[model samples]
Target: MHSRRHPIRNAILVIVGFVALAGEVGAADLVAPSVQKTLEASFSAKGQATLARLAQDKTQGLCTHYATSPIPAKVVTEITAMGFATIKYPADGEYLGDWQRGEQIAQSGLGKQSSDDVEKPAGGNCYACHELTKAEIAHGNLGPSLYHYGKLHGDNDVVKKYTWGKIYNAEAFTACSSMPRFGHKGILTAAQMKDLMSLLFDPRSPVNQ
Candidate 1:
């Protein structure tokens, strides 16, 4: 009799193979003359998408370098320092805004593509990686569930500042983080960051409930 095949094990093996391939063909390999020529021939920048976007920043470069392995502690520290230096707190000392608008922003998944309207404001699309409220059942598990973020993290000044920095640039807290640097990359405005703070910290917001 033939032994039974484990589907999950097979799937994991396939994933491992792909990851190995990616490790061999690291992101830097894409910069090769032949690869660059092929990419240039295949894809073209349009609208908000520019050729400059193809170039990797220091943080992204490090992440790509260590894509297959864990980033060294020293490198992580360097990345964290680089990210921390980029944070700019609100000038008005106000860190909260309309929670309603925040909710809207969190739910929306628009902007930042070549096709997106340059005039319209961008959205955080927070729900894509977090479960913010009980009503919205649709959410992803790539990141931790933030259902009771304010309740768990508290609403103190220290917590407020930390949260703001994390939102502005997640790499500051955890180097090579998959989370976007919202404020650092100009993906969201100061007012929008304040609004997200309100959504996470305001007692009346559904996120806290």
Candidate 2:
């Protein structure tokens, strides 16, 4: 006499058993190359989204390989060093811009996509992965909420620099973070970054309030 498993649990167990039979790592190695090739062949380039998007850079390749596994200490060091080296601080001493404009940037989800207009400047799309403001009920929970970020962490020079660097290259702080390299990749302009900074750190900003 044994307890019965739920339908979904049974389905998952079957899949796990199949993977175990195939040898987990071995199956991944055998199928990944074919899957990558198929993806490359099937996906078409459009607008600013070129076929090069399929190509994995050094960091991307490493991250993808370790997606389901714990990264080695040496590899973590290497990845963070690579990411940190790419960060470029603002030439102008100013770190904060208009918070009102920052709010708009946070709300905007426009950026590089197949159908998007190439001429238009891409947005930060911050809210898509973060809970930024109390006023904006529609927000994602993928990343930690930055509501009262400035209040929680005082606006000091150290905090400012660290914030700027994190926004620039998230991988610099956390290896294999899903956050985009907005500043490092030139996805956002210096002025735009400053505005976003204000959105995060300004006392008057809705995020801080």
Candidate 3:
């Protein structure tokens, strides 16, 4: 009588082989220079947006270089220092603006598109990732929910500074935060950031509710 092999064991061996093959394929894909060339050929600069956008900045390039692992402590410190140096605080020392306008900005997902007018201001699109208000049911969980932000942390000076830094350059807090570096990348103006702060901290704002 022949000994029969277990079907489950056979299946597991096949799966392992497939996984190893996929890993090899993925490694080969990264080595293909034509991939970058194809991407470059596909995208053309239009309006305020340029082909240069395809190129990563220093911080971005560094992050990409260390994608498979945690960034080194020294590099993290350097990046944070560079980001912190770029922050421009309000001249009058005011850090809060109209929460109502902020709500509108957060809700509106318009601006910064290739067809959009560059002369006009941009929207924050904060609601795209954060659940700011209890009324808004639709939100992505890419970032942590900021609902009751002020209620939980209070509007203290330390909290205010941390909020500003986080908004200005999220990478300042988390080395690889998915949250857009709104202020640091010039995605949002300082005034717009102040308005967002009000929305996060204002007692009357639905975020606080």
Candidate 4:
């Protein structure tokens, strides 16, 4: 017995298939000269959000250039090296700060907008991408659950340095990482970075407990 296929369902499937194909074609054509000109004309710099921010760095440029395909191994190495070069270590050889302040900084999602005050401190907004503590139920899962960060990775020189580097410039450790280069881009202060380090390293921090 031949089962009858639903014509409406088949039609919908065909439409969806064409839409997907169109989307792929659109993606490939998005970087065309006309699109670039439109984008350039559409945006204007405001406050700290300068027009220069729209310009991609070498790593970003490579990522954009290879958006439709796999990035070459040589290009990946180049990007990783470029990202690594941006990292700046602490001057006084200190890597920790108040976990209490760190918690505040991580939880608060503020600063770095055109409307925001440039003098004010920017937030890490850690909660937006990670689950730091069991107490905080409201959190996103874009990144790994760092609930027992310090407990999992013991407080040591190597661990501390690695954590700092990761926060400072995530692409330095993982090429094309979504995490912002907070320290490298001057988005977060040294003190703020140290506080975040404490949040991740201090045994007493909520991240550990």
For all candidates, the clash counts are 0, 0, 0, 0
- Which candidate has the top score in lDDT? 1
lDDT against the true structure, per candidate, is 0.82, 0.80, 0.76, 0.78
Candidate 4: lDDT over CA atoms?
0.78
Candidate 4 Cα outliers beyond 4 Å, as residue runs: 1-34
Residue 52, candidate 4: C-alpha displacement in angstroms:
2.4
Candidate 2 structure quality by residue, lDDT tens digits, 140-175: 888999899999999998999999999999999999
Q: What is residue 123's positional error in candidate 3, in angstroms?
A: 0.5
TM-score for candidate 4, residues paired by index: 0.81
Q: Return the clash pairs for model 1, or none.
A: none
Best by TM-score: 1
Ranked candidates (TM-score, high to low): 1, 2, 4, 3
Candidate 3 error regions (>4 Å): 1-37
Instruction: State residue 54's C-alpha deviation in candidate 1, in Å.
Output: 1.1
Give one digit per residue, the lDDT tens place, for model 4 in 1-209.
12365644443343334433444333334244544454456578899888666555656655655555576787678778888888888999999999999999999888988998878898999999999988899999999998889999887899988899999999888777888889998889999999988988888998897
Cα displacement (Å) at residue 124, model 2: 1.0
Q: For model 3, where is the 10-residue window of minimal lDDT? A: 23-32
Q: For candidate 3, what is the TM-score?
A: 0.80
CA-RMSD of model 3:
9.5
Residue 91 in candidate 4, Cα distance off native in Å = 1.2
